[model samples]
Target: MGIKKQLGPIEIIVNNASVFDKLGLEEVSAQELDRHFAINVKAPFLLAKSMNEQLTTGSAGKIINLNDWRKARPTRLAYGVTKSALTGLTRTLALSLAPNIQVNEIAFGAYCHPQIYPWVDHVRISA
Candidate 1:
């Protein structure tokens, strides 16, 4: 694939990069939605597929994807939907690249608020 040829010997592939869209389904513009998918899902998929090409039989490699724990909430529907798809991609790729490559996803939830994060700290998770 293009990735393998472009960047050979990718020992570890970290699907850590992501983009968030705040708009609800009805308010989300086509361009914004496409950008979300491009960075969140498509990039990771291409990288994993490319890394699989470089991996040989009996060789070991890892692909880890960072996902959101708040994906079930309707407020984050667009972002959550894409992350859900990413989770599916992780599982499917794990099966396809099994016996040589290990693929996994991690879901995170917390209350750390960064300055750039637009989400208000009004919502609280009670467990």
Candidate 2:
């Protein structure tokens, strides 16, 4: 039997995967923009749609989107634009999926990237 048969329908979805290309406007390419959006925006949308259907009735569900508040930052164009699109999607989903599913977004600040601080020890990266 499928998971639905064994357990039940999915109740929560957390969109956490994101592409953060450190390329600015002049250096950012079309493919980069597309790739960023494909992962950052499209994936969440598809997942949300699926979850919305699976949770159309019965108990309540929740969709939490992990967002970066640096969407307006000038250093990252594609990431910012896609994040903005996600914000719009989140608002629309919140409005449309109300009563049945709760769609929410949690904007986060910058943290240490492994590439940027390779020696900082991934566990204790507060430095």
Candidate 3:
């Protein structure tokens, strides 16, 4: 869809949309897993493929993948695997698009638990 845009070209793509469900794997259905992969993995891959031509013309285009500690957790099997694939895609793209585009991934740690607790006296997490 974006490739057909008259914006000339796209220099940067950030794959950041994700769904984080705090449920056990058994409780999560196949459809839910598919939805996660559709957004987190497939969307980015398709976007990158569609923009390959535009990206090749740029000197230093960038594709940044947003990852998180959840990717390493075993509990969220589907989310973790999809995110892991995204990280791998990031690395592969970095090498594949070299000399023209740059691919990078930034992994973030979970901070909401200890920070969002309203009953704990943990140093005014909100402040």
Question: Which ten-residue region of model 3 has the weakest summed lDDT?
Answer: 115-124
Candidate 1 global CA lDDT score: 0.81
lDDT at residue 110 of model 2 (Cα atoms): 55
Cα error, residue 121 of model 2, in Å, equals 26
TM for every model, in the order presented, reads 0.77, 0.80, 0.76
Candidate ordering by lDDT (highest first): 2, 1, 3
Residue-level lDDT tens digits of model 3 in 1-127: 5644757577788888987765467867989889878988899888777667755443567788898855754557778878888888888888887867778899997565754475345644465
For candidate 2, the C-alpha RMSD (Å) to the true structure equals 4.8
Which has the better TM-score: candidate 1, or candidate 2? 2
By lDDT, the better pick of 1 and 3 is: 1
Predicted model with the maximum lDDT: 2
- lDDT for each residue of candidate 1 in 31-93, tens digit (9 for 90 to 100): 877887898899999998888877776678899999987776565566877898999999999
Model 1 has a clash total of: 0
lDDT of 2 by residue, 18-118 (tens): 98877889988899999999999999999988887776457888999999876875778899999999999999999998979899999996566665364
